[model samples]
Target: MPEAIHTLRVALPPEAVWDFVKDMNKWAPMLTGYQKHTIVTETKSLWTLKGDVGILSRTVELEVNITEWAGPDRVRFTLTGLNEAVSGEGQFEIRAIAVAGSAAAAAAASAPVAAKAELSWWQKLVERFARWFLGRQGGGQAALPAAPRAAVTAGSELAFTLMMEAGGPTAPLVNAMLEPALIPATEDLAQRIVTHLEKQHGLG
Candidate 1:
């Protein structure tokens, strides 16, 4: 099956990023479709998500398992639908860029960063399409505006990306049908999540 991917970089130390990503209890709700989630263990979780697909609105439930948990650098997980028809895996990777050193040194010696996420194939596709459309529109949708990049500090930057794949092969079509409602909804959710995180860390 095709996979959709989204990435976001934040201006935070690797440890800080890892801490936020490692704990699903804190960040899962940041997702646009997020409804509720429960941690089954350090490596397992259950999720409920609500969103629209074309003209159809739905609430989906799924299970997620952490396959890799390399702190301050990367996280990987697989999502399985509990009452839906979706299954997929995704990962978050953080790379640091520095301003004072040579490109090679900066790349090799930048600050540590971390990311965490849980999503299904269908959800990923919808998110990818929304982003593509938003980028083409130049960011003026009232509900879903373009995501703004922020400087972590004087020379560091933070960015966030989200992609969700629908439950089946027809997800792209479904997403397209729901574009009118989804775009604004997505933008609103994205902005809120960013705002919440920044406030949480005193970066807002």
Candidate 2:
């Protein structure tokens, strides 16, 4: 089977970007295929996704294992289908944008302070669970965290890659079916997440 990769660049600091991407509990629901996801353990999770193959859409369950967990930078995981005929690996990468001595860089470097929000009920619930289980709460108060001031450099980019193998050999069909919904959803979610970040931080 072939792999399908999608990349999206968000204007945020590398660390901030990493923080958002590494936290599955916070961002997994943003994915187009996601129905629901639950953390099973420190490095394991169960995900329910809607398999929207142009011809049909059905819910599927997957067990995911964290294969790589590096700090403020990257995440890699392999997923096994629990009730579907697909399996694959995915990864997210973040990096700091190098700013040259330009007016834009200077302005960005000195951008006004970003605002923060109080935690929402759901966020509080997640925080409470984390506190009980992991002994600590992640960022966010009543709302989500704000994007870092440092924007991705002019040429810097953030990329996401998803590779899946199916029992059958209809790779092209599968890719075609998933791409339309997947791409738009990914972009939409990314925008929403960023908007939420801005609202939380008083940027917007």
Candidate 3:
């Protein structure tokens, strides 16, 4: 099996990060190659990912399950191909760099980021989908609070990793090819989380 592990540090606190990842739908569409996902239940979801299969673009169906939720720290998941011969395990790990808020009140906050450029079409689509799937309330989505307490601040590290293997004679070639794609996906995951948290906390 080949593994891809990537990490990113964001200004948001662990609590805020945890809040976002715990609800898979909030970030699922942000996934690279993401097409759509349907929650079969709370822990299981059917996902369709669009990516290149050799030289041809293809959509692959995957059945994913959330195996564990170590809140404010990690989420473990396992997935298998529904239409192809592949299987993988992945996890999102979160750790606080500094805890500033009282334990009773959970400590973490982010500074306001400068306004960003207009989003790409897919960005707009994903945002719209997330808002619709999670619902929207005026300028902000009806997900988390508009802003966390200004008095709190906690730095956090968010990481993602996956180990996967393709079955068959071309498995090695496929794995080698996938190596490059995972890095970009991981970066996308990090940026997506950071941007969403900042927006959630009214930081823009």
lDDT of 2 at 176: 60
Report the number of the highest-lDDT candidate: 3
TM-score of each: 0.57, 0.62, 0.70
- Return the lDDT, model 2, position 36: 93
TM-score-best of 1 and 2: 2
lDDT of 2 at 107: 36
Query: On residues 19-105, what C-alpha lDDT tens digit does candidate 3 reach at each position?
Result: 888998899888989999999998899999985555666688999999997898999999899998878889998887542343322
Error of 3 at 10 (Å): 2.0
Candidate 2 segments whose C-alpha is farther than 4 A from its true place: 98-156, 169-176, 179-181, 185-189
lDDT of 1 by residue, 43-93 (tens): 999989876766677897978888888766677888787886666666665
| Cα error, candidate 3, residue 25 (Å) | 1.1
lDDT (0-100) at residue 80 of candidate 1? Answer: 81
Choose the strongest candidate by TM-score.
3
Global lDDT of each model?
0.53, 0.58, 0.68
lDDT of 2 at 91: 71
TM-score of model 1 vs. true structure: 0.57
Task: Kindly report which residue stretches of model 3 are placed more than 4 angstroms away from their true locations once superposed.
Answer: 99-152
